[model samples]
Target: MKVVLINPPHTAIGSRIPDDHLPPLGLLCIGGPLIDAGFAVALIDADLSDMPLNRIVEEAANREPDVVMLGHSGSSSAHATVVALCGALKQRLSDLIIVYGGVHPTYHWDEILRDSPCIDIIVRGEGEQTVVDLMRTLKAQGDLHAVRGIAFRDPQDSAKVVETPAAYMIRNLDEHRIGWELIDHSSYSYWGGKRAVVLQFSRGCPYLCNYCGQRGYWTQWRHRDPVKLAREIGRLHREHGVELINFADELPTGSRRMWRTFLEALIAENVPVLLVGSTRAGDIVRDADILHLYRQAGVIRFLLGIEAYSEATLTQIRKGASVHEDRQAIQLMRQHGIISMATYVVGFEEERDVDLWRSLRHLLRYDPDQIQLLYLTPHRWTPFYKTAEHRQVIQTDTRRWDYKHQVLATRHMPPWRLFLWFKSIELILQLRPKALYRLLGHPDAVFRQSMRWYSEMGRRTWLREVFEFMFKTVRVREGQSLKTFLGPTLEAREYALEKAKPANSARRIIPLTESR
Candidate 1:
């Protein structure tokens, strides 16, 4: 069988503001297994150049592959583009098997299959092993119903959707190698032109933050062989001329002992590559003693999920971290010379003018090296979706569902006013004297350059967002409630963790036509 994997272009501001791009780790992961299974596999990263739909279609047509798999890390926001790409590809190659996978399609499989005739199959949850099984089944012209972890149109009734049993999570992440050979190393870079790639040390998070879409999708926490991953990173740096690695794990430091071991192993490699990734604040504070090893291991920055400041809000969201830990983590990272990026999320709760002011004040108090303000984007499969089900949805367009854009409306303020507050908080946090001083005058040249690079990207993104919001974007004044718009929640039907339990103990799969 022949296969082609494509990373569709995304419209998120972060995707467009930077000059460099990272390899699509998910597609690369799936590619590896397919290649090892003796399939003719190729990768077309449209995101590398933000290729147009016509060009992407043309490129896939040239490949003449039997199957084309599509996925994106920014799944929710990039979904519409995937649909359009699938349609164009189907038009060009009618016999092509169009497979779509990602967080968005995993839970919304029924809707996607029913609405988009171009898509032949939806690979739910993890795609690595499932995709391989699917390919083998297709090769032998066997029934797709025998393949686990997939959803497709029923053979008897095209209008009906059939979801096979969920695929078991990969017990060991090292079972499949990443198809790094699928892409040109020189084409991808991060942090202002340093050759870079996205790698994962672990999968899933142990802590359950209610709004988290990743935790349920990943099923449970699992890590790769620490020494093996370190060796791989070293090889990429030495052989491929890669200088930076962005960890794609939701919680790389979920296990302190494992994380520390990985740090020590990477340090042993003596590679000079820079590292950046997100982790919980409590984990940083827990690893305060070995943080120097983190610096030595090339961890220049860690984005702590300081999603909220108030203790009550933290508890409500089950963030599992207190405000004190959040502040202490920032201090510890600074003391160890590792940059800390506090990710403060807005819209977890209804916020008024005073609440926004309070959030800004708290952020100033934390005094992290960087700050990323994101809106809470509730996914249908998450527990948080039920909490937000009745709230009015201001932005109906799925393209803007990225956390950068506000989806749910607040009773206290209009969309314009809310956007202004969000922009103001971001501007104040980034342009504050403390932040500017470090961006311009930090003693370490590497840290200084990193800060400046981020500042420049943020500046362009800020301006573009302001202009777009004022003119290009549209928001409904009196939109349908979230429940009315997205229909009943699918949390029960799609959560991977629930599906992993014993058959008798697991919740029964809800029928497709049943109302929640």
Candidate 2:
């Protein structure tokens, strides 16, 4: 059997602004197992070159593969694109098998199967093991009902959707290696054009942040063998000439002891690769003693999920961290010579102008080396979705549902005012004298370059967003409610978590004909 994995191009500013690209880690992960299982596998990273939909269809059709798997890291935002691309591919090749998977499809499988006939199957949760099993079953022309962790159109009645039992979580992450040979290393780069790749030391988050879908989608927190991961990092550095590793993990430092051991092992390997990733602020505070190990192990920066400055908001979202700890974590990282990026999410609460002002003031006081302002994007699978279900949606287009865009309407402020506040806050934060000084005059040359590169990209993105907002972007005045737009919530259908339930338990499938 032949398989071609497609990483659909994304419209997010981050994807468009960067001069370099990172390999699609998700596709490559499943590709590894398929290759080891003796199936021919190839990767067409359309996002790498931002290929057009027609070109993507042409390329995939030319390959004439038995199965075409499609996914994106920014699944919700890229979903429409995936649908269009798959539709086009099916037009070109009528008998092609199209499989879709990601955070969005994992939760919204019912809606997808009902609406998108171009998609043959939706692989829920983790796909490393599921893809292998699925492909083998397809090769044997066996019943798809026998495959776990998947949803497909019923053979007898194409209108009906059948979701098989959830696949057991792969207890050991090292069981399948990434298919590094799938891509040329020289083409990808990050942190000022240094050859880079996205790697994950762990999966899922232990914290129960109400607004996050990661905890539910990933099922539970798990990590690769610390020493083995370190060794793999070393090998990538030595053989592939990878200079920077952008961790795709939600929280790499969830386990302090395991994280420490990984750091020590990486240091022992003497690899000089730069490491950058996101982690909770509390984790940084917890690892205060081993901060030196992080710096020595090539961790140049850590983006802390500050989420909000107000204690009330933090408690409301169940962020599991206090404002004090957030402040302290930034200081600790700075003291250890590691750059700290505080990610402050907007719209977590219904913010008035005064609230925005207060949030900006708090951010200035925290004094992180960098800041990322994102909007609160509620996924149906997350707890926060239910809370915000009654709110009016401003952006009806699913493509703009990425955290970069404002989705829900604000009762206290108009869309224009909210956008102005966002731009103003971002401008003030980035143009602050302290941030400017670091971008131009940081003592470490590497850090200086990184800051400068980020500033340039941010500036471009800022201008592009302004242009789009003024001329291109559209928002409805009186849109449908969140629940009405997204349909019913699917929080209970968490596939990975369902693995622990009894076999005789009720199936989690919800048919399209059921009342919303």
Candidate 3:
């Protein structure tokens, strides 16, 4: 069977930031299982390749795949591109089966099935085993209804939705296959200009921060066996010659037992690799030894979601910890000689301009190695979504939903002004090279950090950007003129809209594997 897996072009939301990061690791995970089942598999990371929609369709038509599989990160706007691409594929090859999978499909499967007639199956939850089972069924001409964790449209009516029972999560990690050969390491790099290859040590997040869909999706934390994870890391380095790894798991620091063992395994393997990715704040402090291990295990940096400084806001968001903890975590990482990248959300509900300033002041208190300020995104099916719906706070369109563009108007502040505020602050941050240098000074640190910033920013290009956004753009907030944009609303606006939908539809195929 010939199967083509695609990471659809993501122009709708992620395009604002121009760096084409790593290929969709989700698709790569599924690719292994399909290949193991004797299916001819090809992966097209359209997001990285920048392939035109028509060109993608034409290429698949040329391949004449038995099954044309497309994957997405569940951004509704981006999903539209996937839908359009799938529709085009179906038009070109009517007999070809089309499948979709990812975060959006797990919760919104019924809606996706109802809306997208082009998609044949929606694989809910993890893709490794589910997708393999799907391909096997197609190969044997078996009943599609028997496949677990799949939702499909009723053929007889084409109006109703049918759902299979939940697919049991895979517990034994060794049974799963990681297909590294499908990816060409030379083709990928991290969004921030590191030549990075990625891996997942665990699946599922246990925390219930209201702003996140991760905890909601997996519902329970499940980790890959430590030995298997270490072996795979060794394999990625040895076989692929890839030097950098981003552990794209929900939280690599989640397990004391698993993380410690995995670290020891990697140490024993003696592979020199630079690892980076997101980790929770509280978890970092709780596991200081794990942080030490991460440094030894080649973890150069970690991006932690601090979210907010106000305890009231933190409690409102159900972050399970405090803002002080967020700072402590960064300090701990710094102490352990790991660079701390702090990510915060601004413009959450009831957040005024004053509140934004407070948060920014709070953030600067840590003197983070790097700071990423993002607008709060109220994605579909999250607790934030329900709350936004109840408050009548959702934004209306594509422009407003942009992560860079503030979309929602609060009772106190206007949305566009909030956007300008964030842009202005971002501009200042971009331009304050001297101020940043002073704050981040260590002779080697200053030199290496500046080079990295310059490399990622295209040699003072970020400085140029600061001048343009700051000088050219005029922002009006509640009809008030300000010298610059504000910061508290810089991140925590709960009414924020998503650039893409994360809705999961029926007929998505998950990857599966049984043979070791």
Predicted candidate 2 versus true structure: per-residue lDDT over 1-516, tens digit per residue? 889999999998789987978899999999999999999998999999999999998888788899999999999999999999999999998999999998889888888988888999999889999999999999999988888889898887776788788777777999998999999999999988999999999998888898887888888889999999999999999998999999999999999999999999999999889999999888998899999999999998999888887888899999899999999999998888788888888887888999999989999999998888998898888878888889999998888888888899999999889889888988998999999998998898878887888888889889999998899889999999999998767667643445464646333445666544
Candidate that beats the other on lDDT, 1 or 3, i.e. the better one = 1
Residues 1-516, candidate 1: write the lDDT tens digits.
Answer: 889999999998889888989999999999999999999999999988889999999998888999999999999889999999999999999999999998999888878887799999999888889999999999999988888888888777776778777878887899999999999999999999999999999999888798998888988889999999999999999999999999999999988888889999999999999999999888888888899899999999999999987999999899899999999999998888788998989899889999989999999999989888998888888888999999999899989998888889999988889899899988998889999998999898889999999988888999999998999888898999999998878879546633353553211233445454
Clashes per candidate (backbone, < 3 Å): 0, 0, 44
Ranking by TM-score: 2, 1, 3
Error of 1 at 178 (Å): 0.2
Quote model 2's TM-score. 0.98
- lDDT for each of the candidates? 0.89, 0.89, 0.67
Q: How would you encode candidate 3's per-residue C-alpha lDDT over 355-439 as one tens digit per residue?
A: 7777667766766766666766566556655455433333433323445444444666665556555656555543466436534
Error of 3 at 380 (Å): 3.0
Better of 1 and 3 by TM-score: 1
The candidate with the higher TM-score, 2 or 3, is: 2
RMSD of 2: 1.4
What's the residue-level lDDT of 142 in candidate 1?
A: 98
> What's model 2's overall lDDT?
0.89
